[model samples]
Target: MTKPRPPLSKELQLRVFRRDKWVCRWCNRPVIFAPVMRLIESKVRNAGRVEPLSYYHTHWTRDGAPLLDELGAVIDHIEAHSTGGSSEEPNLATACCRCNVRKSAASMHEWAKRPQRKPIKGKYGEPQHWDGLSALFVVLAKRDRSGLTASEKDWLRVLAGATADAR
Candidate 1:
């Protein structure tokens, strides 16, 4: 059997997201950090309780949080990982949940089979500042400190530093 794949460090994932400006490389759509969507959905003003689509990777067609399921950000392999691509930053790209699942480990040949994605034309042009809703995530995460996982605490420290640098 092939050796089990090691997880990519969260820091590396963030780097790709940053480099791509929180836009999906494939479709040029703005992407939101998935966990941030979850937090928003859990609020009383939204769904009052975490909906199944919010956390269970059930983002296909839930009505309550439309974008939550479809535009959630994820790191994707630019080169098909199933075909020997390494998880190095150079081989990674930021993709939305829709594109990520659709592009799953597709080789260049399979990719060619899919329709080419043209950059979307919007009246406002490309977004000037998009952090994948990461700043909002930090704010919510700060308010829910006790709920943070170990890695989230690490992210808080890292992103908190980035946020301070921006001001």
Candidate 2:
């Protein structure tokens, strides 16, 4: 059975968010800080209720611009507590609501290898690039592979490409 994760204090959440520069570590997307006062005013103006905000993932236009929406932020455990991971700062990172939900209880390396839908290019037919995922793969490929699983090793091999130094 998995142990219950320890509760994280608001102070600790703030610290981790700041440490990660208010950005989702996995997708490298900026966290949207919704202004509480503005929300309150909107609610008042809308008869004590406002249109529900989009707390889900963000969407980008074909031109590579964000859709001017808010993305909920979360602090994720890089290594899952179910797998004996800790709640220490080193194991914490800021993530968007989308990435956090998708990565629940999964290790970073495992989650990285999962296939993702390719984004569409702009009208001019510019190539769509996943710079964030590419950077993450490069970093993971360069890490020590002594304790990696077979699947992880295979992923590293593919990520590292033929030109990478022999392990």
Candidate 3:
């Protein structure tokens, strides 16, 4: 029997997201840090003055969330873990929810058989500035640090260093 895999550490997941610039490996789409979306939802819902619409839940609904339904960030194994791939950073990739769900456990060759995401044929092509709204997440996280989970706190530190290096 295949043993159930343990949850990937938030630290490792963040590292992969950073490495991939939060773009989905399969679709080349910018992915959102879902937890940040949840925070935004809570803040918006609590503002009593702003209630005409609702932010969709991260893992639910066809209606797009604040960033879009397909944009939730996830870590994918480059080689299938079930097929004996290691869980190391090099073997992991950042993917959006839509592509990850579609690629579920398929071998690369099999996944290649799936319809490919079309490239932007525009003169400019894909925009290069996407950081998956990670900057926004960092800002909001600092504003609401009282509720941060240990993992989130670690993210703040990592991101702080990143932010520092960028300047």
TM-score on alpha carbons, each prediction: 0.78, 0.51, 0.78
| Candidate 1 ranges beyond 4 A from true positions | 1-4, 45-65, 116-119, 162-167
> Per-residue lDDT of 43-67 in model 1, one digit per residue for the tens?
5434354425434234445464567
Instruction: Tell me the deviation in Å of residue 4 in model 1.
Output: 4.9
Among the numbered candidates, top lDDT falls to 1
92-114, model 3: which lDDT tens digit per residue?
A: 99988777778878778788888
Could you tell me which 10 consecutive residues in candidate 3 have the lowest summed lDDT? Answer: 51-60
In the range 13-118, model 2's lDDT, one tens digit per residue, is 7667666766677776665432222232333455645555432222422222222232356778889888777898898888765677688888768887986323
Cα error, residue 135 of model 1, in Å, equals 0.2
| Model 2 TM-score, 2 decimals | 0.51
Task: Report, for every candidate in turn, its global Cα lDDT versus the true structure.
Answer: 0.75, 0.56, 0.74
Clashing pairs in 3: none
Look at candidate 1 and tell me the lDDT of residue 163. Answer: 65
Clashes of 1: 0
Q: For candidate 1, give the lDDT of residue 75.
A: 87
Cα deviation of 133, candidate 1, in Å: 0.7
